[model samples]
Target: MPNRYLGRRIGKYRVTRLLGTGACSWVYEAVDQDLEIPVALKILRPEFAGQEQAETRFRREAATAARLRHPNIVYVRDVGQVDGTAFVAMELHPLTLGRRLALVGSLPETECVRLGIGIAAALAVAHASRVIHRDIKPDNILLSQSGDAVVADFGLARALPSGSFPSDTNTVEGTPHYFSPEQARGRELDHRSDLYSLGATLYRAATGRLPFEGDDWYTIARAHVETPPSSPRAHAPALTPQFEALLLRLLAKDPADRVPSAVALVDALAALPSAPAHAATLPRLGSRTVEAFRPQVPGRFHRLLTAAVFGLVAVLAGWMAWGRTSSGSSAAPSPRPTSIDSTGNPTARGGAASGSGIPLASSGPPRDSTRDTTRHRPIPAPVRRVRLDLSAPDSAQLYVDNRLVAVGRWRGEVPFAPRLTVRAVVPDAPATCHTALHDTVLTRVTPGQRLVIDLPVRGCAVVRYRVEPRDARVSFLSLDGGNTLETRADSAVSFSLPTGRYLMRISAPRCITFSDTIVVRTSGNASPLPRKLFCS
Candidate 1:
C-alpha cells in the first residue's frame, strides 16, 4: 500500500515519501516549498488531531525544543497546522543512532565518548531552558551526514512552569528499556532523570545491550526500579576504565548519585582521555583466574625506594661498561625526578645531576636488567572456550558464524572463536519492523561468562493511550490479527506493537463505536489517545 500523504502539500511543505510512522504521528521526507530545501515533516495522525491536549503539548514542547538552538540538537524549521493536520518541520538527517547501532552492534570507546559529549552538551542547553526531554533513547538521537550526534524528537519534552527543579506528573512515560528508576516508579522528576536515561543509551552504545531487559514493558520497568544493572565492562571488555566508570556513575539507581547536571556531565566526558588509567577488572577467560594491577604513580616513599634501587643498578651497569678507561669517574649522579611522556619515554625534569658535575652521557645511562626484563614480557591469549545463552522468537533460525546452531529458543554453550557472529532470522517476518531485524553481536566471551543474545520476531514500538468514560472499553486488532490489545480508560498505557496497520475501536454502552486505523512504525511517541471519544 502507498502512503496517501505522499505528494500531498501541507502548509509550505510538500510531503515526499514516508520516512517513518509511529504511534502518534507519521514523519515524512518533505521539501519546504518556500525555502526549496529538504526537511523532515512530522504530521499528527488524523486519529490524534482531536486530542487537543496532546496536540497542544506536542506543539508547545516542540516549540520549546526548537528554541534550544544548540549545535547538537535537531534544528526545527517550522510548526503549524494545515486544515486539521498539525505538523512540525525539522532538519533531516541520514540516520539515527538506533539505526547505526543495528548495522554495527557496538561502537569504539573513543567514538562513544565523542557522541556522548555532544549529547550531554545538548542536554545542558535543554536543561538551561528548564525543558526536560522526558524521553532520551537511541531512536531520539540522530546522526548527521557529518557524523555529529544530534538529538531529535522533543515530542516528549516539557518545560516546567517554575524555576524549582523537580516537577510532578501523574503519568509514567518514556521507553521501558531506558527509563530511570524514578521514572519507572512515577515519582517526581528532574534533570537527573534525563542523565540516567542518557546513561542507559550510552550503555547500549558501548555494550550492544540494554542496561536492563525483560519480557515486557512492566517487567523492564520493574527491573529499572529494582535491579542493579550489570557493569558495561562485563559485556564489552575492551572499554577503558574511564569510560566504564562514567557509565556506571550515570546509571546509578538513585538520581543523586548521577552526575549533578549536564554541565558536570560535559566535564566528566571531557576528562575521559586524560583521566588516569587506574585498575580495571578484565573479563574472566574460560577458567583462568583474572589478574589485574592498579597502575598508579608511586607514593613519595615508594618513589624514593624505587629511585635508590634503579640508581644503584644503573651506576653498576655504566661502571661495568666504562670501568677500565675512567679510573675516577665520580659516582653516577642521582636519578632526577622523571616524567613519562605520552609516548612512554621517560624525560628528566626538576634538578640536574648533584655529585658528578663531569658532563654526563646525554644518551641516558645504560639500561638495567630489571628494565629489560619487565619491558619484554608478552601478554597471554585467552583460553579458547565460551558459553552462550541464545534467546530468539519461536521457530526463528539461529546461526553462529553462518552455521545453523538451533531453531527457536535455545540455551546452550558454544566454542570460542575469534570474532564470534550470532544471528537469528524469523521464517516470514522481519527481525524488527523497520530494519532487516537480524541481530549481530561481535564480542569475545569466556566459558565462565554467559552471553545472553536475544533476537525478536520483530522489534516493538510504544504508543500511549487514554480513553474517556472510565467504563468505556478500548481494543486494537492488527490488520493480520497477529496482534491484539485490550487497554484501560482515562489513564496512560503503553501499547507495544510491531510495525503494521491496526484497527482501533472504542465503545461505551450509550456511545457510538469510534473506529479508526493506526499505523505503527519504529519512531515517535503518540500519547493520551484521543482525549475523549465522541458519543452519539
Candidate 2:
C-alpha cells in the first residue's frame, strides 16, 4: 500500500515522512502547525479503525502517557481523533538506547550505571502512580541529544488500583529475552517485575548479550523460570565484581529476592563506586544485608543531570554525526512486539484478534529466535507439562476431557496427553448467536510447548429484500463458504445469517437474474429499509 498520510495533513500536523511502524499503528514525523515544532505522530492503521479493541488500546496508550509528567518519560503533547482517525502527538527524540547499542557493542561500567539510575528514577515515579509498564526493553527507551534516557511506548501498560496486582496468564507479554521469571510463569506482577526486566535490559547493555537465549519463545521463557543467569563478569571480564553482583540480584527468579522497589534500585546502583572494587568488599549475591554496610548514597538525580552531559560528551558527539549520516531518523525504533503470542504469530495490538477476516498487521517483523547451544540443555522430568492458551469470548467456559478447566483469558499447565478433547461454551448468549459446542481433539503432545486454540462465536444479522415482481425468488450466499439462504413466493423476504459479507442473488420466471454483493453487520448500523431490486 502506498503511503497515504505522507505529504498530507492530519488535524494540524503535516506528516513529513514515516518514522517507524508497530503492530497496529504507524509512527510518522509530523510538523505541528500550531506549535511549529516537529513531533512524532502515532496513528491507528486503516484496517483497525473500527475495531473496538484496537481503538481502545490506541487511546489507552495516549491516556496512560498523559497521566505521567517526568523528565525521563516521553511527553505527550496532544491526542485527538479527527475523521475517525485516532492519533497521538509526542515529543520527538533523535536516538534510542537500542540504536545506540547496535552502534556500540556495550558501554563502560560507569556509563551503564549512570543511564540505569536515570531510568530507575523514571520507573520510581511511574510505579508511584500505580501504573505498570509491562513492556520495558531497549527499543522502548529513547535517548536525547544530550544523552538523557526517556522511557516511551506504554501500549502494554496497565493502570491497576492501589495494592492490587492481577495475574495476566493469558499470554506472555514482553520481549522474550527480557521476560522476568514471574512474568514468564504468568503469575501476579508488581513493581518488582519491572525491576527484573530493567536488570535484563542493563545486562544486555553491559555485556552485549541476552541473559537467556533459545531457539524459540517457550525455550527462553522456561530458561527465565528455571535457569540462573551467568555472572555478567563472565561475558565482560572487565566489569567490577560489585556491578556483577548487583546485576545478578536484579535477575533473581523470585521477585522477593530482587530489589524491593525502583527507589531501592536507584539507591543501590548509585552507591556503586565509579571504579573497580576489591572482591573482599563486594556485596555477596542474594544477600539482603548488602544495603546495611553500603555508604550513604547521595541523591543521584541532581548529580546525573549535572554530570551526564559532560561525562558523555564523546557519545553525544558521535550520535550527532551518526544522525547527520542517517538523514535524521526519529527516536521511535519500531515499538516492541507486544502482540507476540505463543504460536510465534503476532496477534492484534490489544492482545486479542480484531474479528476481521483480514490478518491483523504489525509494523515490524517478529524478532528472530536464535538457538543457544552453549547455555541450553534439556532437563528431564517424569511428567510432561504443557501450557494451554485459548482465545474465546469473555465469560466463555473451557473444558478438557469433559471436566471444566478455566474461563476467559486463562493460561495454565496440563499434563501431556496424546489426544485430549477440548470444548468451549458461552453462557447467556442469544439463541441466534450461540455456536454449537463440539469436542476439539488436540494431538501431537510435546513437553514445554504452548498450544493456542481459537473458538469463534458466530452472531446473526437480518437482511430484508424486495423484488419488482411480487413472487420473485431471492437468495443470499455467504462468500466466506457459509450455507446459502433463500426465500420464495413473497415480494418481501427477510433472511438471517451470520454477520459477514455476502453475495445477494434475485431471480424470477420472466425477468433477468439480478446479483449484487451485500454486507451483514453485527450492530444496529445494519440498514432497516428493505433493499429494492429492479427486474426489467
Candidate 3:
C-alpha cells in the first residue's frame, strides 16, 4: 500500500509494526532475534541528516538517560546508527498514558495521584544529576498493564553549566503549552522549569485539558508569562486542596517561588492520601459466547474440549478464592462480564446487547487532541500618573544653559520634565571636571512613574565594578574600604558606589599584575566600564 514499513529488520531485531510517529522520529515494536525479547526502537527521520547540532543533542540525551536507573524511569538498552538512521532501543510497553486518557476520557483521582507520585520520583533522580527534561507531557509517559507509570523522552534534556554556556542560547526549545515563564521569555532556565512542565502535564491528565489552552504558540507563550493558570480543583473538584496547592506552587511564575527540588515534590505527593475510587473495571475479553464457525468435532476433539473445560474451572476456582481472601467475603460484586464477538455485538446476561448502546472497555491509551476554542473577554483599562527627583554631591553645582539652577544636594519631586541637563566643576581637578561637567542629564518621565538621578562631586569620581570571572581565584578591592568583591571562575560579581578618588586591586595566578588608582570626577560619563574577565 503506502510504503508500509512492517516486516523490516534493523540491527539484531526484526520490526513487526509501527507504534507511532512524532515530529522528528518514528517508533516501532521490534523483536530481538537472539534474546527473543520485544523492544521498542526509535529512529530519527532522514530530514535530520547533515545536522550536526541536532545529532549531538540527540546523542547527549541518550547518553544521559542511559546513566539513569530508576524504577519509574524508562530503560534505554542500546543506541546506534544503522544505515544513516540513529536509533534507540528501549523496553516495549503495552500502552501510553496518552492512549489511556483518550480511551477513558479522564483517569480516576487515585490513578492520577499514583501516577504523579511515580513521575515526581523519576524527575527527582533526573534533577539531582542537573538534567532537565524540557518536555513533560502525557505522550511521553507510558503506563504498564499492571498500573505502573514510567517517564520517557530525554531527547530535549540538557545539562546546566555553572555560569553561562553556548548551550543556554537555546532556552526556548520546548513545547509552548508546558514551557515555564522564564523559558517563555527566552531567559536562562533551571530545574524549576521542568517542575512547571510536570505540573501542566498533571493538570491535563487529571482534567482532560491543558491549563493554558490557546489556538497558537504566541497566545500560549503570552499566557504563560502574564496569566495565572486555573486552579486544578476547578475541573476536578474531588482533588485534594493540598494537591491543588502543590500544583500551584509548581506553576509559580517565578522560579524562586517553585518547590525547591523534585525530591521535595515527591514528599509532597507521598503525603497525600490515596484516590477515593478504584480504576474503572474493564469488561473481560474472553467471556463472550460466540457461534462456532467450524464443523462439529470428532471423538478425539471432544475429549480434548472436556480436558480444557476442567482446566478452566480449576483456574476460576483459585482466582475466586484469592479474591475473596484479599477483598473480604462481602466485597462489592463486579459488573456482569461481557465481551465483543467477531460479529460486533456484545454478549453477556441476556440476548446480544445493542452494539451502539454498550460502552467500550477503555483499553487504549490516552490522547492529546482535545482543543479549547473559548475566547476571552477584554478587560477595562486604567488611568495614569508620574514624578521625578534629582541630586548632586558637594563641590558640584548644577548648571542649565550657562545658568546655575541649584547648588549641592538639589532634590525635589517635580512635575513631568524632559531633557533637563546639569554640569559640575572644581578648580583643583580641571581635567576631572571636564568629563563630569556633562554627566548629569534627565530624560522624560511619564505620568504615574518615578525617576531618581544621582550626580557626583565635580573634582572626584566613583565607579561601580563587578568581577564576573571564569575562575574564582580573583578578588576585587576598592580604595574606599566600604565595598569588596570576591568570586570563583563561575560566579557573578557586582560593585556600586558614588564618584570619588580610589584605588583598585585584582589578584589571580599566572596572570599580569592587577592594581590601579585614579581620581574620578562627577563631570563625565563613565567610560571603560569594568570588564568580565575569563581566566583559563
Candidate 4:
C-alpha cells in the first residue's frame, strides 16, 4: 500500500502524490499552501524514522542542499517536521534525467553539452560549499519542461574539510558503473570523483549505453577499479575528438588525471571543437532514450549462465587514437594502473576457476611462458564483425557479453567472440514480472556470416501467494487445460503466465485442496501480486 499522507498536509504543504521512493526516503509532489507553490516534499520513510543512521542521512541531505543554492542546483525551500516525521521541501521537477533517457535513446550533442554545463555549474556551487556529490548518476539529475537540467539528491554527498578532501574506501557508496576507480577501492575522493561520474553520464547521453556491462555488481565494480573503457568514438562516431578527449580524461582511472574540477570541466566543454548550436548529422542507434541500469545486488556468483564464460574479456584492444587537438597538443593514452594489474599477483593463478562467482578480469592470467618461448606467439587476431538480425518488441535492448549492441529489430555487426552470450530485456516490464520473458542466446558467431534470431518473449503474469503449511504441494495450471507444473509451496510463489485466467491448487497434509483463480494482464505495469490470500 502507498504511504499515508498522500492527501494530508505536512507542515505547510499538502502532499498530493508520490513522485518516487527509495530505500531511505519518499519524495512527494506537494503544494505549499502558505506559499501557494508546487514543491517536492521529501520525507524520511516512517519505517526508518527511528533509526539513527537513516535519520542522520535524511537530515544531512537537507543540511547539504540548503547551503548550495544555485540556478542549476535544486535548493531546499523549507525544512520542517510534523508529528516527529521530518521532511524537506524543495523545488519540484517533473522528471529525472534517467527517466528522460529511457524515453529517448540518447540526447543530441548540443543538449548533452548543455546538460553537462548545467550539472557542472551546480557541482561548482556544491564544491564551493565544501560538499562532494559522491553519487552523480543520471538518476539524481532532474529535468524541467523548459529543457533546463538541475542537479538534485545529495543523500550520498559528504561534507569535506577545509583545504583537504579524502574519502574512506571501505564502503563503496556510489553506483558501480558511474563510480570512480578510487571510489570502487574505497579510497580517498575529491571533487574529481563527481566529474568521473559526469563523464559516464555524458557517455550514456552521447551513446545511449553504459561504459561498462556486467551480470552483477562485483564484476562491474572490479572493471571500474581495473579495466579501462574504450573511447567515446567506439560507441558514438559523430562526437568530436576534443569532446571525447575531455570525457576520457574525466574517466581517467587516476583521480589526479581527471578534469581538475567542475569549473574546469565546464570551461573545457564550452571550448569543445564541435561547439555548434546542434549536433552533427549521423546515424544514431537505439529506439528510445534509456538507461541500461541494472540495480546493484550484493556481489554473489550469478547462476544465470555459469557455463558461459571463461576467457571473458579478450577485446581486440584497438583503442581509437586521439589525434592533434585545437591547442596542438595530442591526447596521451592513460596507462593501465599497476595496482590493479593481477598478472603478477600470487592469487592470479586460476582465481576465476575457484568458484568465487565474481567476474574475472577480461584477460585471464598469461599462459605458461616456457612453452610459448619455444614457439613464436602468432600475431593477435583482429576483431571480426559478424552481422546479426535480432527481433524484439519496441524499446527492447540487446546485449552481447554484457555490452549493449542493439535495440528492437536490429541488423548490425558484432565483434566476433566464442561462446557469445546475448540477453535482451524489455524496458517497460517490471523486473520480477518479466524475469522469464527475457531472450538469451549462447553460441558462437562465425566471422563474415549473417544470422537471424526471433527473440522469444515469455508473455506471462506473476501471481505471488502463500500457503498455510510450508510444505504444501502446489500445482499450477492454465485455464486452457495445459500441462500442470507442480512444486512444493514454500513461503511465497511468483509465476508468470500468458494472458488468461490461471488456477493454483495447494494440498496440505490432511487439509482439503485450496485453490485460487488469477487473471494475467498486459506486460507493462508489473505490480507484484501482493500475497494476501492465506490458505489455512
Give the candidate number with the greatest lDDT. 2
lDDT of each: 0.72, 0.73, 0.64, 0.69
Worst 10 residues of 3 by lDDT: 282-291
**Candidate 2 lDDT over residue span 1-536, tens digit each:** 21455544788997655666778898887789998999989899988999999999888998988887777789999999888888999999857788899999898888788778767777877787788898888888988776767888888888888557664565668888887888888778788888898999999999999899777988999999999999899899989898999999999998889988776787677668753222113332111223333344436885685367445755877898998868736533433334435544444454343232224335476433342222333334468878888767565566665445676556788888877667665532333443523347888877888888886644556666555676777788989777787887373456666667788887887678778898776552344434445555
Q: How far in Å is the alpha carbon of 132 misplaced in model 3?
A: 0.9
List the candidate 1 regions with Cα displacement exceeding 4 Å: 274-536
What TM-scores do the predictions have? 0.52, 0.52, 0.50, 0.52
lDDT score for residue 523 of model 2: 55
User: Mind giving the per-residue lDDT tens digits that candidate 3 earns over 184-215?
Assistant: 88887777888898888888887777889988
lDDT-based ranking: 2, 1, 4, 3
* lDDT tens per residue, model 4, 369-480: 3332223354355778777787875555665554456666777877776556565654334333343245466476577888777765433455555555677777778786
Error of 3 at 153 (Å): 1.1
- Where is model 2 more than 4 Å wrong at Cα? 166-171, 275-536
Query: How far in Å is the alpha carbon of 25 misplaced in model 1?
Result: 0.9
Clashes of each: 2, 1, 34, 14
Determine which window of 10 residues in candidate 4 has minimal summed lDDT: 282-291
In model 1, what lDDT does residue 286 have?
8
